[model samples]
Every structure is written in C-alpha cells, then in structure tokens.
Target: MLVPSCENDGGDSKIDIQYGAVINIQKSSSSDTYINLVALQNGGDINLGFTIDKAVGDITSMDVVGLYIKSDGTTIFKGKFSTGIKTFPYTLNINKQKIYDAFTQLNSSDDFETGDQLTISAELTLKDGTVLKLINDDGSNNFSSNIASSSTYKVFQAYNVSCPSELGGTYEFTTTNVKAPTGESAPGPLTGTVTFEDQGGGIYNISDASFGGWTGLYGSGNIARNVQLKDICNKISYFGVDQYDEVFTFSNLVVNGNKISFHWENDYGEYGDTTLKRTDGSNWPALTL
Candidate 1:
C-alpha cells in the first residue's frame, strides 16, 4: 500500500459547486515495484489519492471510488473509504487483483503476447452521486466520450519476456531498407557496424553507431551513453544522444531474435521506423571502450 499527499483546488464562493476533485497516482519508493506485469499477477496494489476543496458541508459518505480501465468501460477495483473526510484530504487504494483482472480482459485469452496494453485510469463517484469525468466542460453524466487516451493511461505492453543473454557481439546493419512515408524516399540504405554490450540488469550499451550515411551516434567519449534494452521482447526503452548530439528516443520496438524494428523520433520532431538484422560479425572489429 502507498500513501500520497493531495491538495484541493480552491473553489469559488458559489453555493452548490462547493467541492472539486483531482486524482493522482503515487510514485513507488522502490522502482522495481512500480506497476509491472509480474507484480500485478502476484496481487500488487495501486496507490491513489484525491482532494476535495471548500466543502460546504461535511463529507459524510462517499458513494464509490476506484481505479478503472477506459478501454472496455470496466471498473476492475473499487476503493474503500471507511470514514468520510470532513476536511480537505483523502487517499485510496486499488488492489493488484483488480489490475490483473483488467489486464487479463485486455489480453482476451490465456497467452500474453507483445502489444497487449494495460490502460489504467481512475474514477470516482461522490456522495451526491456525481461520476467524475476528466474533460474540459463535460457536464453530461452519460460520459460516452471523455476517456483518457492510452498514451497517458499508464500504458504498458505484455510480451513473452526473457532475460538478455548471448546477445553481445558486433554486427553490420543496413538502414536503407526503411520505407519512408508517402512522398518521401528511403533513407538511402546506409550500412554500419555497431556493437551491443550487455551491461547486466537488462541494460545493454550500444555503441559505434551510424545510420543513413551519418556518423557520431556514439562519439565524443559517448560510446556508453546510448543505453537500450532487450526489455520484455517487443518493448524497447531507449534514450541517448546521437553523434550530432541530437537527442532521440525509441519505443514499441519489436525484437525477433537477432532482428529489431522500432518507431523512433528525435527532439526536432522527425520520426520514422527503422529495422535492423544481425550480419556476420567475424570480420568486424572488436568493440572498443
């Protein structure tokens, strides 16, 4: 269980509209326990909080408060509030079983594969029977439309994950095969040999990088800076500065054995998908620090 502090927004002097609600997800102290597939399966808990400001009357009872997934309009877990907050602050807890059930519904079947998303969000019903919706000016109780998008919904993909092993080696990869979007030509098929070094703990250092006839992805003593991961097959978390010092990040990558394909975008707003396959590393120079 987690306890998070919340602050209520100052309300107007109006009579009827006395309370306003805001929900927040608390950050876990331990990074490892921060909402993962394994933890949810083992009955992990989600910590949540809210604040009700300028109550005209004491909050005697709350009808309902819970964590929900907007995708299927399902409420996986409901929180319990033993006593109402006669004041301004309150917290809630969502059990792991709720989250696990939601994910299981998303998966639709027994097998967990890549691209299955866990879309988590919060919902609550006040004592006056008003259901909260996170919209600009939606006063309708029939909330057929105000759900949050999957990107901002604490999204995580389910994959057949395995530990990184024997993946270290030098390989030549070609970038010319990338199919550009409509009205754009390919990146002109540049080939370069890059190295992947296992740094343990699911982290891999990528270096000696180059793509599309450009160099410097790992330069300026920055060979170890571009750390990526064979994280949970089909899910790649990448962060680094290229040789030109332009920052880029990769996500939703598909890794099939020695091959990798990903959607990448840079700080300048340029983005594309690049696919790479392992080539014979026997003739490639050994990785240098």
Candidate 2:
C-alpha cells in the first residue's frame, strides 16, 4: 500500500482535484469506511493521476464526474453519474472513441508495471448543474490498456548502443573500472575496431562483455553486467529505472560471417522520460529497447 504523500520521489507533486465520486466501504453492519480518492487530471499534459485511500477493495457508492471536451469546445463523449467497477477497483472505462485518447494519456507515464495500482473516478454535470460521481469495481472494467512485454525501453544520447559489425573490424573490450550507468569505457580508445565471437548455444563475447539468456533471453540479469564466461539461462525480462533489479540478456547472435554487430546500452533513467545514447548518429539521443 502506497501512502498518499505530498511528494513524488523527492519532488513534491500535489493537486486539489478532490472532485468526482468517493468509494464508501460498508461491511455487514459495520461502520461505513469511506475511502476518499483524489484524481488530478492535468488539462494539457501527457500525464494523469489516480489517488485512492486504500491499496485494495472497492467503493460501492459515490458519483464520478468527467468531461469529454474536444478541441472545439464540443463534447466528443458524454456520460452521466456512474459507479466504479468493484472488481477492478478504481477504474472507469467508457466504451467510446474517447477511450483511445484516454489510453494515450495513461501510457505517457513510465510507471506502467505490475503491482502498480490504477484508480479511476469521474464526475458529470446533471441537467440541474449538479455534480455526480459514477463507476464501480467489476471484472469488465479497464482502467487502461494492458502493458505487454517486460522488455525495457532504452533512450540514447551521449553514447549509443553499438554492434560489432558497426565497428567493421576486430575490436577488444577491457574494463579497468567497471561501474553502472556511468563509467570509463574500456579497451583504451572510446572509438575503435570491435570484434564479436559467437560461440553457439546462446553465447557471444562482445569485446569483454558476454550476453546470453535462456529462451531467446540467453541467461538472466546476474550474468549480464558481470564478467563471466558461462552460458546462463533466464526466461525473464524487465524494465529498469534509477536501478535495475532484473537482468537484461541478449540472445541468438550468431556470427555467420565476419562484420557482426552488437547492440548495447548504458541506459539509466527515471519515471517521466528515459533517454539513450547512440554511436554518433543522425539522432544524438535516440530511443532503444
């Protein structure tokens, strides 16, 4: 359960959009445990928020209000008072064209991962100018589109991911002081000829770094960043921000001929945006996965 604080990480992010509906919990003859949630939807930003009182459970009552104002002051989609989906917790899914735009807004943030809770509420103006809340927790409810693939997205900038074939020569990698996110590039010159030896069975020697994971993943995260000469296997992929607790592995890189290339990144980022580095290309800071 995440406590609603006045800060995000170290940066304080707060809002006053306490409008919409509320989830009131009523057990068998028990006190009505009202769960107050606040959702601050930025007018013209790529981000939105859902704040709920508890990490779990559903709220039966409360009318959620929402507006579907378009570019020309026209309501593209309209809705009245509703209840949240109890099974899906705090998510309100309107099965209309506006659903596409809503997805774009939700996917703008980089915090889409498992265990991350998404609560949704809406408010509507009645004919009498009265505000009402709607939506309830149900299985058919969808807060946003499902995020498939654990593969991480890497952005490039200063140093881009390079392949051995890109070097077009036999290059060697030797690390003097290995580090994370930042460190001195190895084998003397930052730019030089690179070589890749494909040893079949999910194993490749990139300069001094080895990459492989099980089931197209070569191995696991433990074998990726460390100096090892083993063909480890892992069936997992993950995204990393600030720090990566999961392993990133490469696979099935065979050296049929010479001039083989290896793509790698020293990507380190946060929630808003993640940038990557490319090997001096048309785009300085590009996006890589």
What is each predicted model's overall lDDT from 0 to 1?
0.38, 0.26
Q: In lDDT terms, which candidate is top?
A: 1
Error of 2 at 79 (Å): 11
TM-score of each candidate structure, all chains considered together: 0.34, 0.23
Candidate 2 Cα outliers beyond 4 Å, as residue runs: 2-58, 61-83, 86-221, 224-263, 267-289
lDDT of 2 by residue, 141-196 (tens): 21211111112210100100111111212443221212333332222122222233
Please list all clashing residue pairs in model 1, or write none if there are none. 176-189, 216-243, 217-243
Q: Please state the error at residue 59 of candidate 1 in Å.
A: 10
Model 2 residue 289 CA deviation (Å) reads 8.9
lDDT of 1 by residue, 36-102 (tens): 4343344443332223232222233332222322313333323323334343343334344434443
